[model samples]
Target: MDPASHPEQLSVVNEQVLNSADRSVTAAVCLRRFLCYGSESSTYSTKECPLGIENALSLMQLIEGGRGSEVVDEVRRFNLEGRAVRPNPGLFTLAVCSQHADCKTRQAALRALKELCRSPVQLFTFVQYKKELKEGSGMWGRALRRVVTDWYNGQDGISLAQAVTKCKHRAGWSHQDLLRLSHMKPANDNIALVCKYITKGWKGVEEAYAEKDKSEDLQKVFAYLEAVEKAKHSTDEQELIHLIEEQRLGKEQLLTNHLKSKEVWKALLKEMPVAVLLKHLGKLTANKVLIPGSPDIAAVCGRIQDETVLKKAKTQPFNILAASENYKRGHGKRSKLKWEPDRDLVQALDCAFCKSISTVEATGKRFLVAVDISSSLSSLCRGSSISTVAVAAAVCMIIAQTEPNAQIVVFSEGNLLPCTVSSDMTLMQVAGLLIQTPGGSTDCSLPITWASENEKTVDVFIILTNNQTNGRENPADTLKMYRQKSSVFSKLIVCGLIANNLSIADPEDCGMLDICGFDSQAVDVIHNFALDIF
Candidate 1:
């Protein structure tokens, strides 16, 4: 049976704290719950497919039945009662609302996420889109250097010319900061206008330039503000910020792509219903097309230089109908290959990625991670962690799988993707060696029981997942078998993530010292969790 088919044969707990409790206490409680009951609450009706706002609760309740119905109702009751409770729930709820088709729901989610930025964890979300932080050796670098160089200089006029001169020798800079800088305006007699703008507060800069707009972009924005001001009802700052960012997305036209992708985006845009002024700005920004995917594609090409070798790999395209066709477009090709792909195409490809993503960066500490993608992982793609999951998965790909020279193992029902150091192979190249497929159950014991049945002194066996797990037979059965076999060594560690309030039995099954949720600094968590497991 699919391991997911059962309530993971695990124990469970508090489940209530997520909604009404203090975030700090809730955070701590949630972790403890996972440690205490890490596996419990098993039964038929206990499990029900989750839906809407009450989703995560339903997942836990699924292992329990008529009581499960009670669980669902309780979750809803908690929701309504807590209407006056924690505002953070809004942050958690909006993410799941992506599944909803209405614009109001989506807008709410986006707004909540934006508000989360004020929190310390804001940097986690920020890291994903930050392709260019204030780094050196580029135009942006020059721009920043320019600002730092003259931030204290010229008590008189700090012209754009001087700023440019400062950055002329630098190589890179922060695009976001630079963009913010460009929007700052000075007062008529404001000595060192930049400093003046900064001192007078952000409103001062916007107000100073609010009326004297030079570009069409600024004009549309001013008009939007005017419209909003005319409205009798005042909107909150978050609502205003959401509209502005929407305009930014529309302006960049980043969503312009395939028919399906475009249609979905358009529908979402309408559902979001930004002000006409915001929509207008989006359209204007959309029109200013950036260089089409060239530099990014070029960088990718440089990563994989073997033309002949890469050509052979494309012999298979899982999705493209014309994937198998021999296609190339280059100076040295036989028959001048038609529509062939360029190198560094992994960005678009759904291949297995590892943690060593920044090959260009320095070497990182090495470690091992063993994950059971058998079930439970559905949590990563659900709840407030969904977006975080994708980003985390990408990071992991760079780490674990990126090292073709490292030893790696992936186990799931009757199958395993395992590698050993051979004379001709390096573990760093392992991620490139296997294709991942989600198996139905945590039948990992089948192969493990076979391999270590007679061996001793084995390395670590870490299970990376959301703590809830159910097996066809019993995960415990495998644990017993594990103990019975193995002439050498055995150490087991289970990393349960966001599994607020887990339940477990036979304390021995869980080698972890009652840990729950995830702490990013733990090297094991860093190496094992999906790149998307943020």
Candidate 2:
């Protein structure tokens, strides 16, 4: 039998060797939990026993001595979770592979490395770690060689060169293994030239071209490089004019392709004519390239008076949420600029809800927005800079602006209190109030129970949470109880702020709806349910 197939055998062997030591028992339990938790038979029926990245890392660290296969099994479980449901676990995987000597463990580590390096930011991080490896170290050298070999064979030359460049500039170390691997794949001329320039100099490029008898094309390549250099140095006005001319040449291709530098983008926004800039602002906001609190952002906001522009800007909140989440995952970094809410952007988020409401006739339905301020929500919402509570607050603001009859409440640990949400409240004020509220254990049922006790009637109840409720009462059960006591039939909409396979909504109930994350379409989903049009 495969050693990996029987974790119990490994545990028994470990217990005997450790002579029933406390550490050994702990290690065995962690390993058993990891294996069972990742198995298909495990349903995660209880919230307390969920398998997470921390559990996988703890298990790998606890095991000791010649149990290479068992360690590999745990690492395999981690790899599967990261690929399927969990957020990025690259750092933990890297830590394990760096410390362990097992060949199987190293192989699993290589696979995780490949997955992690798919993001440019993560690739930069790996390159920094690679720089610290001692010259000719057996473990890391072998692993780094395998990574480069895979990149070469897979024909991912651009990514390979990008990794090498970022490593050299940021880490301040020359990667000889990557240089050698580049020569192994000489058919990729672009990668070859980039490697040659970095490892040697322009002289290396001449020699490389002479050897391949392609010296005639060298001038064109040099000209392109010179153009890029010039573009980098050009003033904002000159860059804007050049971009406009280029757009004419390419029949209005995305402006993002030309303005690659963040500084240049900011400069163009400040200096470009309002009419000229408005044409491209829609795509810029959609791509989320605009930096928050930049002067250019304010300028763009001031000039966006067109209804079409406002409609396009309506999706900015969703884009910001996505970008912020990516930043938290180590895939990107946040700007140093202080985050101040732009009035125009806030209006745009409100417009998104208005647009969704306009799709159906205005029913003047009353909305009750309940935000979960439980202690669990204080954690970063999937590596994002914003907390789960902050997102919940933003959603409440949207409802307040769209529905005149909307009321807001904050709940935690079976306690519910009215929030001071009003149409005149600024976005920053709303966020501050919600984030400052004290939190305890999660009680998703508190809001519904509170509403039922107060004899309140609302057409829709919107609950924002991560859905890891540890309340004395389940939300669905509470909703059922509320319906029995109250004559009004209110729809319960749970907006999950985290991505997970588990759902709180009953599949058989049409009145209960579950939506995940800060998706742009969430406004429409809530609106459709309110209208009973779904």
Candidate 3:
């Protein structure tokens, strides 16, 4: 009798594997949840993924025992350089691994603090996580003091002033509280003025420093800061627009009322990042900032198509696709805002979606892309209207478009049917067709078994699913038998549509990959894995 065939036996075996797994395996499993689902809201008591958080802290301790900084390095890389949809989850894990838990010294934590906290928002999230975890226990410890102090001293004067003005307080802690608790002595006069502004506002800057206290040339650094202070109180729309254009104030620095001005948005559009521009297309169009044949239309369309800007912002295909889907509806998904989307702008977004997708060099490998039509996959992805089946369809379309020898199919209990696809269909249309697929239980092994029975030559099998298979045949064994029958080694790639711990990929199979979330990064991974890039 095979113990792996029994649920109780398999559960015990899986537990043993998890317990004995090395730091690398443990870290991957723990970080998978964060990389997919973001951190839980502070309004709630329980975490978004408590098990993942527990495993993360445990992994940190395991790595710290070996005097390694692998977890820290991974978090830093994901937050700073990777095309992550959200950075706060990484920041939360980094805070857990860094400040709350430590090794002999605070080197890893300090390094992450200095490197990852690139902006005040990131710093606030990091500090908020720390506060939520410890609740002021050792919040004033020497190690934390050093971490906070070094973070402030690391930035230049002008940049630091702008950072301070971005966010006043978050997660029940203000910069004033941090500075006071850390006892951070400013590095210089400019730093001193910035610190004063954080603690006491512009009046504090005036009270602390006289006109002649600074060196003649050094006082100019605060010119932008002075403008920001004045802009906060100015009700004149023209004056606010002038300040934004002249000083290059970020959207975050603008007041609530100021955002209603079309001219202000136009001014901010000149410097808006691609990701931000994609998000506010509805508002921009409704406010008449982006219209048919307007200069702003050309600018917005050009920025969306700018390869360098998209790459720099790490823009994801799903973002552009989602924006297009929402924009084409002529109304906001969650708000009452409405606009007539420009045909040119919509075309630019669709073009950008394809261009933003990560690609790999085709290796002429035959591919079978199977999408699960299970009832669970019909449910919407968290925080988005894109259903899991929609994600599967988008991924299927991607493979068919990129690979020369790729077949697309939808699978349901013991059934595998070829899906009709056209080259001219938009991503949204493909998604709609897939979502309308009759929801049923999934037999994940159907694709492998059908291919084996038909003697179809397949090099890579890409399955997009929620992994909630209710079929009798085991996927791993089915793959093994198919490989034996076909006399050809084949690989399987499972793209998980939701954040869960389930995986159908065999642990020992080097050719199989279980990736969470169907994003551009996952597409890159699928392509590389198909080519055996590892």
* C-alpha TM-scores of all predictions: 0.31, 0.44, 0.78
Which tens-of-lDDT digit does each residue in 1-534 have in candidate 1? 232433421122232232211111222222222212221222001112222233234333332232332222222333333211222222233333322345454344343344333321222222212222212223223322333233323223323222322232212333234334444333223333344333453356467865563455444434443323322132343433344344332322222231123233332343332222221222222332111255533433333333342343322111111111111112222333223243334322222111123221212323234455554343432222232233223323433434443334556666665544233332224333332556666553443454454342233444445435554544445544554564322334444555554443233222222224443223322232211111
For all candidates in order, the CA lDDT equals: 0.33, 0.53, 0.68
Estimate, for each residue in 159-185, the C-alpha lDDT of model 3 and write its tens digit.
887777777777677789889989998
Give the clash total for candidate 3. Answer: 0
Off by over 4 Å in 2: 1-57, 61-88, 98-101, 127-140, 152-187, 202-226, 230-346, 349-390, 395-534
* Best candidate according to TM-score: 3
Ranking by lDDT: 3, 2, 1
lDDT value, candidate 3, whole model: 0.68
The Cα RMSD of model 2 versus the native structure comes to 13.2
Q: In model 3, what are the clashing residue pairs, if there are any?
A: none
- The model with the greater TM-score, 2 or 3, is 3
Over the full model, what C-alpha lDDT does candidate 2 score relative to the true structure?
A: 0.53
**Cα lDDT for residue 26, candidate 3:** 32
